[model samples]
Target chain A: MFVTPGYAQETAPAEGELQTEIVHEEGHGEAGFPPFDTSTYPSQLLWLAITFGLFYLFLQKVVLPRIGNILEVRRDRIAHDLDQAARNKEEADAAVAAYEQELADARAKAHGIAQTAQDAAKADAEAERKSVEADLERKLVEAERRIATVREAAMKDVGTIAEETAGAIVEALIDRKPDDAAVAAAVGQVR
Target chain B: MAEDPIHQFQISRLIPIEIGGLDFSFTNSSLFMVATVVTAGAFLYLTTSSRGLVPSRTQSVSEMSYEFVANMLRDATGPQGMRFFPLVFSLFMFILVANMFGMVPYFFTVTSHLIVTFALAMIVMLTLVGYGLKTHGARFFKLFVPHGVPGVLVPLVASIEVISFLSRPISLSVRLFANMLAGHITLKVFAGFVTTLSGLGAFGVIGAVLPLLLTIAITGLEFLVSFLQAYVFAVLTCMYLNDAVHPEH
Candidate 1:
């Protein structure tokens, strides 16, 4: 049965060959499909082995490693750059914070100086006012003492003049001059 | 003539070289395989030659591709899985470049072949097995045995697990192969319809417009599929490798 089937299959391709010849002169003639042809298997396998083997070697030795390295290097470089950028940003943030702090400190120092200058000016004005008031008070006291002395002198002079006038009137009216000691005593008693 | 869509996938021997009775002929598939490597290598070298701290557009794309695979491995297998980054990354770039190149007109799609994809899948499987054995010693068999299994079902479950583990490479390789093959075949059939119909008559030409439009649309979808298939392949490989690394459950 197997022999009969094999013979029938061979005849089928033979028939196909005769028909194929009628259509095209250069027909491959009963070769059927190259893939089905077991005759060429060894050569095909050999070449596949050779080519694929070399291709494998080429990839392992040259291609994959180079590409792998490129990818790895790019990845590392990117990560490094990102890290550096983050560090720089942090530094910038710190610098800004320091600058703001210094700015606040400088403003406070300026305010303190301003307050101290204002206090010193006020103290100086207060001292000047006190000295001027003291000088004026001393001058007023001296003027009062001098005015009292002058008034007392004028009153004494007036008393002496009055006694002299009274003596002259009495001499003219009675033609007799009172005794000088009595006149002096009378003036003193009247005063 | 109904052109065979399968004809697009024929491998023609370009330079027949034999050494020690071995048929090591460089064929169209080999040419495109070399082209895929060269293009991928040039793309990486040119874009990364600058190694700019700030990458250019092309450089960014290159870097994104690297990180894309790296992240997938790390997520699936953790940091320890990074030891297999070169292998996983190589598989991803190779498949991705090969698939994208296949979308170009007249370019051979190497990954469409089962042999090529199976070989890649085998490498993933081998790596898994080798590493699992090396790291975990005989205890790696614990991967096939679940932690919480009833005594009656242990044999059944363990057998199923072993089968599933063994099937990884087949499924992984077939997924890529079938997707590429089916997509390319569909695209070719639709494209063929456009040509065949247009050649018939004016009425046929009018009918051809639909297929033409479909072909264009499918081409766009194919590009997306190409990238997705590559991503799936790489992601599945990572998961498999993860099982190898941590095989407890």
Candidate 2:
């Protein structure tokens, strides 16, 4: 059946042609489904081969590679960007750690300076207080020594005055002048 | 308004190109096949021309189809199966586009024929066998001998598996062809009912409404079938090749 019945294609003719079509089908002739027609197989296969082969070639060579490339580029870009982000974050973290360390060191340094200044001031005050105390003690000792010397001088005068007064009283009470040697001897015996 | 639903499938010669006395004339079927390729190719090529890092809507469709087929193959046969991506992608696109083209009014379904679908199925089976054998050598036969059959039933099971293995191409071809052929024919017949019913006077036109609605509904269902059949074909191809990739332990 290289050929289908002529009336089977694109046209439903009058009753006579329809009757002929039915008769051909009754004979199990070429009046059947169009795809089942073996006559068209080679042509269909040929064109199919041509078109499909061309299509396959086009895709394999051009389209698929382009798509794969685009996708790969995007994937690589994303991975690279992510890596950059991670590196930046690490650097930031290190910077923060360094800053905090510097801060801690400066704080300790300030504390040490304050402690040294305080100690220096306390030492200076202690030295000045010690010098003032020594001066006051020296002045007090001088004043005590002067007062002892004055008291000694006054005591000596008092003793001599007492002796003279006693001699005069003796002279006034006696009518005659007394002998110097005997008066002196009596005073010495009483002393 | 011809009652012959078979008229849509007629392959009229558009450009009769006979070669060396064999009737290799370019027909309407060939024209539509070209259309399918151009449509699929143009849509993909133009949409991805910019190769946008961030895809536009149409570009997303292209990428989605790529990932869709890629994921299907990858999932079925792992990364090793990516080698067959070009073939699988082409087959998926061709069948998908052909089926969709058939859905348009009066467009010839290139894949509606047994020879066409059978040829496609043979492409897959041939690849499965050729690559499977070329890579695995004699070990490729291990696909016929599954694991864990008892010693007594190993012979029986191996023969059964061999027959099943052989039937893969036939089944694959027939599934797509029959679905496309039968669905189109059924749609034609139902749509013909509207024509036949409306030809009668007033009341017949009114009765035509039911078949018209049915025809619309079936058309929607056929569109789903078009996409699904393509997916199923690709999935089965991947699975069949998986046998080649990692045979029974």
Candidate 3:
């Protein structure tokens, strides 16, 4: 909606006079409006240019750089965290591998020590049994030799007793010493 | 008709004041600009104060404002345009506030004035040119001289491109100023009609009622227009910025 044209300015007046009147009237046209002067254009333009320059400087120098720094920091932090996690994982894996190897080696050593001890015990048992058998065989041979000796001695004693008895019998008939004839006669009597 | 609109313009004396070599008065326009600034500050402050996750009324409005500009930038340029979100957002908010402030009973629409819009447009143009020059240096001159053109056609194309580039400020400034000025003037005319009609009898009262309803509808539409115009201004700025950032496209 527009304001009505003020009484539709008198258009029938002389052209040159009307123009002058219109110019005069225009000076009071919009009382409430700000004055429009081309003189201020240059100054206004200067201010606008200055404002824009300041804004650009602030953006390029301060604001944008700060934002860029933040992004860069975020990127580096992520990369650092990832790298540290990888390194820690590698260290953990190496430690686990070493522990497993040590565990296997310890078990093998324990098994070897047990086997050596069992071999030593078995060898000692074999040597003790052989010594016991040898002692028994020596005692058996000594006992046989002693028995033979005793038997020989007993036979001799019997022989001696027989001789004495025969001699005594001869003496009872006629006192005689143990000579060849007496011996033969005693032998016949005994027979 | 005055040959210069400046001749038509006069600074009325409301409260006489002096500042340096200038006559500084608390005139209607000055009062309105102050009101615009205050309203803008308060509105933005209140809307953003309670920044809620689920959006308590205020936060929703704030988020919507952000999203609106974000979407516009993306649409005008590309997804990469999100980088200019804050710049575009601020631009939209400033313009929207300025336009809406003028809608109040007695306030000046700074954007309707040519000098203000021209200054804003000049900044965009300067940024575009400066950024292109900084980024591409000597090769940026190639923008005016397209590739694959015969030597004979180069001059014609170069001239055309130069003319087009030179017109950027004019087109940008005119678009915003014209829209605001025209809309306000139209609204004033319709309101004048309603007031005039209301003075008559019953039939005149009925006529006044119709115009009044139309005014109400148009006012709501104007509010939407204000937001849209701000969006348009910001999107264009972002597009220009993008061109400067990557000029080949």
Q: For this target, which candidate reaches the highest lDDT against the unseen true structure?
A: 1
**Worst ten in a row by lDDT for model 3 chain B:** B2-11
> On residues B1-249, what C-alpha lDDT tens digit does candidate 3 reach at each position?
321122222223355454564544444444444455455445555655544334567545655665676667777778765666655655566577778886774456767777868878876788678868987897777778877889999899999988988887888888888888767666655666687788787789888987788778878888888877887898789877777666664
Which wins on TM-score, candidate 1 or candidate 2? 2
Compared with the true structure, what per-residue lDDT tens digits does model 3 show for residues A1-191? 02223213322222344343222234332322332534233433443344434444443454334433444565687899999999999999999999999999999999999999999999999889989989998999989989989988986676656667777776777875667566756665665
RMSD, candidate 2, Å: 5.3
Q: What is each candidate's DockQ, to 2 decimals?
A: 0.29, 0.36, 0.06
How far is A10's C-alpha from truth in model 2 (Å)? 10
Off by over 4 Å in 3: A1-4, A7-191, B1-31, B49-51, B74-85
Using DockQ, give the best candidate's number.
Answer: 2
lDDT agreement with native, every candidate: 0.86, 0.84, 0.63
Q: What is the DockQ of candidate 1?
A: 0.29
**Candidate 3 backbone collisions, by pair:** A1-B186, A1-B187, A1-B188, A1-B189, A2-B185, A2-B186, A2-B188, A2-B189, A3-B189
- Order candidates by lDDT, high to low: 1, 2, 3
Q: Write the per-residue lDDT of candidate 1 for residues A27-64, one digit (tens) a residue.
A: 45334445766667777888888888888888889998
Q: What is the TM-score of chain A alone in each candidate?
A: 0.58, 0.60, 0.51
Docking class of 3: incorrect
